[model samples]
Target: MAGEPQPSGAPTKGGWITFPFLIATMAGLAVASGGWVSNIIVYLINEFNIKSVDAAQIANIINGCVSMFPILGAILADSFFGSFTIISASSLISLAGIVLLTLTAVIDSLKPAPCENGSTLCMGPSKTQLGILYTSLALSSIGVAGTRFTLATMGADQFDNPKHQGVFFNWHFFTMYAGTVVSMVGFVYMEDNVGWGLGYGLCVAANLIGLAIFVAGKRYYRLMKPQSSPFTRLAYVIVAALRKRKVLLSSKSEDYWQETQAEGTKFVRTTPTNSFKFLDHAALIIHGDTNSDGSIKKQWNLCTLQQVEDLKTLFRISPLWSTGILLSTPIAIQISLTVLQVLAMDRHLGPTFQIPAGTMMVFVMLSSSISLAIIDRFLLPTFQKLTGTSATPLQLIGVGHALNVLSMAISALVESKRLETARSYNLNGNSIVPLSVFWMVPQLVTVGVGEAFHLPGNVSLYYQEFPKSLKSTAAAMVSMYIGIAFYLGTAIIDFLQKTTRWLPNGINDGRMNNVYWVLTLIALINFGYYLICTWLYEYQNVERKELSKSSPYPC
Candidate 1:
């Protein structure tokens, strides 16, 4: 039985057959995560009696935490446990967090009483209550960070062909967006109309179901075992380079350490390129650095040429990564403020139904989901045909920046219009302004379209350009950018609030349009910085492949 193939109809290790299970798990987790996060501002303001601005700030900080922690999760996945184990364990943690969050909604003692209608003063939550709430949020945020990008890497692992991986990535975003749409619209509606407890209870159920489905499909996964930590090697390279800093440089490739076959693997190592020549010293087989079999005699004294180059590659790419942080900060601020904008505007569809403030984010998700398909299927192909080449990732990101700048301008104009309407009505004291919430849609849609370009573009660029040792880390790099952006945006907002009257407790009395204008100026400057970085950068892998295939021209 051990040697035999058993049954003709038995399931295989990995194939298209695993798609349904993977997608179902993704959807369930997305719904669960979105259910809590999409409505957090409203939940805090209404149920916990927090100020609107303060609630948005908390939401941004939480978002930053969720995005940033993924780097640690990815490191753990690539260096120790594989993605499946991390995903399973993190789902359980998230489920526990959701259960606690649901308890806060259900138990009267967990939250302060609701503010009376038309009353400005409300009791703040006690330290004990705030402590429990924050603990629950921290758990869920950590849980989300563990699973988000890790699942994409796992699904990509199932496919050997790069084309198949590309297709899977598209479906990953699609499923994520679809789930977010459901949670933002349906779950948010439940929270606004029925009760927060029921909505959060559904989140708990979704997390449980997602975890179960993932566990059930364990046999079908193509799990990658963790090797020694890549970060450890990167650190070794830096240390070795500094130690050999006084040594003379060499132009010859033969002087550096490269494997005929990489240790413990059969694949031949590629020759080191000429870039970042200073790092070549790390691989120089200087006196007392290596043993008889060419093994390193001292861990901190010698590293392979590939490892040094890997560190250099990260250094070269970092400026580009920093650009994304600046690009995303404005978007983060816009997202947080847009919810508050919705609260102050007319949300009616007709006489019977009104849009929930949280549900408006569904437009961004919907735009991204639909726009992704169009870009992948139609836009990119058309550009490739007309230009006789595929658009590079940098080019795609450039387009995204242009779109984002446009979105910011529109946001400023729309806010100005809303504020003008408020002044005309002399309704500065009223909670609801006369402006339609739908006016906010153009900016959201534009931001979504920009995301459709930049997000996948960054993922593809990192995956293609990063050294083979750091694939999972590459995916998390995108998360790191967004995380820093959120936190930085929080700092900027707090700073502005403390220094100026542009953002007070209420928006109607504040110059929100000026904030948008400031964001627009920052975005434009960041775009210029990105252009310089992209212009100076070379694609290491792509350039080498092109060079190897090129023939010398005859005189």
Candidate 2:
């Protein structure tokens, strides 16, 4: 596998192959870790008594916290621990969580009682089940946060610098989907059919394998130093932007001179313009009458504070991006809530029909994988060529979400019909839907395209907007979006079941029918968010050469 034994002494371009493999290994681990939780939603709902929405909330809290933690993980990875130590530590904690889950599952008395929904019988377990689950989830979150950033950075490491990495950047995402392709099958099977103890035990084993793979390749992998303090600097930018006095611009003809005193030296703002004190750097061209000679004097100062604003300003204001990702709540629900909902409904998927609740995920990810191959191999490039703008990722996302809007619209419609039938009968593995089970396949495929588009969008967008100093921070944006989307989805579903149409006889009321529509509404909101983000996108790219400029660390 190391290819022709490396010829003992000869130098090789192994970096190309080795670096990518290492990254894939890490990405694969991330997928498996996450898949464990994703596949468990059904178990939590059916065997454990956790309700559809609450189960989703539980998954969201765990997954979201892990993602949110990366902000800190980035801090730690950059400053104190470095990628190796932090990633290792995170994996161990997650391992501990898996161990605990297994032990508690075996003990039985330690498990949580299912939520108090009248739809199913309530079973008693240990009062500590909930606590143990929370602890396990939190541990997994920490590991996930740690793993996510390093892998992306490591993937980017395969390229000499960020410049030539553009195509690789696209491949990076494709490989990530590749890992999902595997986990979608492997983890889903373990979580659903195997039950909790062995299911989590396998997760632990997979993480161990993943960790070993990382350790073995430590010599080949690259680790970058943390660029800057996100929180501290963000705070500084906000205070500076708001607290500083505003500067007024003055202009004139003969010898046109404008000045402001700052930090002492009669600082010239630009080579050709009046001084503006507020901007760290400013560029301007001024018209001035030269004695008997006509000349236009231009001044430019690479004003850091004024022109670029401070990176901290990003912290001060983040509404649009946050809300936009929040719209993706259904994504989180799909893995957690929807998986459970699908499992509980007495699927009629027989030899010609039955779709394993967890196993179906492989098809879901397969759709994404095929979509990725098509997009990276064809669709995105083709779209980019036709659009004449470098907005490949956004274009796909916008279109995908539009299709998604329609797909969910169908889900909402189908679910409504299904629910009416659900009222009189409890659906099971052998149960039938009013429409053929095949109808759900399109919904699955729609979710798949959204997966492909959204994942790449998060990766590219963050990498671009984040200045060189904060590329690692930029990497975490995907996790953050996933987190927000998951939580918001849960909130919306909960709101619907508890507050509106589903309230009296709503899906949340221990019934399968109500859960479907709640998910439908969430998809609609997410679609709206997707539309706005696509429209407002000021698509940008990071030149590979800038990678050398941004990082003092070696790739």
Candidate 3:
């Protein structure tokens, strides 16, 4: 009864019945997050009077924190609170942050005096003002960290079939991008045209609505119970292996300790594999390692073979995971830099409509949304029909890597052309160039397509391959690397500003094209490293012979 599959459309706690509520909530939160985050660069410049490069650096730090904090959220969910509790609490926290942010927009005392148009002199925000802004950003970022990937994991948990889970991931990203598109296009326009206060107010409303929708669907959720920290088990495995470092290896399965079931019940025993053989010592049946009844005497000294293998699995996949950090770093740099680029370029569309500088990112989101639809609806099915197998996650990631490299190259070329135009017009020192902002569309769309390929591929691979005990944490791994990438991007920008002349206070006064070239080189090198890692990597879950028969696309 425990493992039996629920009939389709049966009265169940989790299934397609929960889809609409989850998707709606995801879209709402995305709109809320995008409203403030997408426009923060302009807000700092116009409201707080911060310099452009400084604001971008600050934004990068905030992005890094938002991306990195998800691991802590995942840990809390996996070890103590569970997804439902964490998401609910986080939504409230996010609402509080947005309220504070809106207050900053409405209250003149909360920000600095605006600089006169074309005036070089500007008043910086006082310490108190900056403190309030930082606090609000911190709270909002923490809230986002908790809900973003955890929602993906929870949505996937609603279905037992891998194909269903894959489809859910596709829709999850689509809804997220769709919501971001709305915030970037709609809310950003309001912030630029109507008022920042009204724009932030909309974010607060969206957060409240999303939270309400999530709560309303509580009855249909199949919540996973919190397990004690999976990381603790991993630590125990490492400790046991190191303690038995000098012990001889055993070739026989009986020499390893396996976790047993209820008394007198039969269970399959897991034996340590030859890969990462040193860790097998943790599971070796030394004297005093087990009680007379065959239970573990000390967890710190004797780990189950299954635990050993879980640690080994992490070791095997970590190289691939490291590749994602480098891959993401360039994109993070591009995102912050692209906003600056848009600000300096002509944004007028037709007669009365001038594109919001912040809304340039909408192109990336829109491209990703469209590409996801095509990939899910046409590309995957077509690939399966032709080859009798769906495209592997590694292959998808590889394609993303190549596209990312090309995008960086294109960004460099575009930046070079923008600079040439600026010099031709004698525009300098933060002056806007006559170049159309649409010149950036190609690079933005390329990166968006790359994200559509890699983001889901990375998540699907991590979720499918990780041990069951670490499911939530597995989903958060992608966030962790992305966080690291953002930090790395910030660090690189800071170093370039301090050491090189490429990035200055005014991007037009510096060689911004060179920055794109550097990122392009970094991406190219990272792709080569990724190819090596993928070459050495073997599938632990998706490519299993039995599973291959059930689903062409296990991931």
Q: Which candidate comes out best when scored by lDDT?
A: 3
Which sequence of candidate numbers ranks them by TM-score, best first?
A: 1, 3, 2
Q: How many steric clashes does model 1 contain?
A: 0
Off by over 4 Å in 3: 1-20, 156-170, 246-252, 261-271, 377-390, 471-474, 542-555
Writing each residue's lDDT as its tens digit, candidate 1 over 1-555 gives 011232588655665767888889999999999999999998998899888789999999999998898887777887899788888888888998999999999999998888888777889999999999999998999998889888887888887777787788778867887888899988989999999999999999988888889889888877777767788899888889899999997666667788557478876545566778777778887889989887889868988888988888898898999999999999999999999999999999998798999999888887987897788889877876786667777788899999999999999999999999988888764369877899999999999999989987887778777898886576688889999999999999999999988888788889999999999999999999999999898887556345233211000
lDDT for each candidate structure: 0.85, 0.56, 0.88
Tens-place lDDT digits, model 2, residues 371-408? 86676667645654785444444454566556555555
Candidate 1 residue-wise lDDT at 210: 87
User: Rank order by lDDT, top first?
Assistant: 3, 1, 2
Q: If both were scored by TM-score, which would come out higher, candidate 2 or candidate 3?
A: 3
Candidate 1 clash pair list: none
Cα error, residue 123 of model 3, in Å, equals 1.6
RMSD of each: 4.8, 9.2, 3.5
Error of 3 at 121 (Å): 1.7
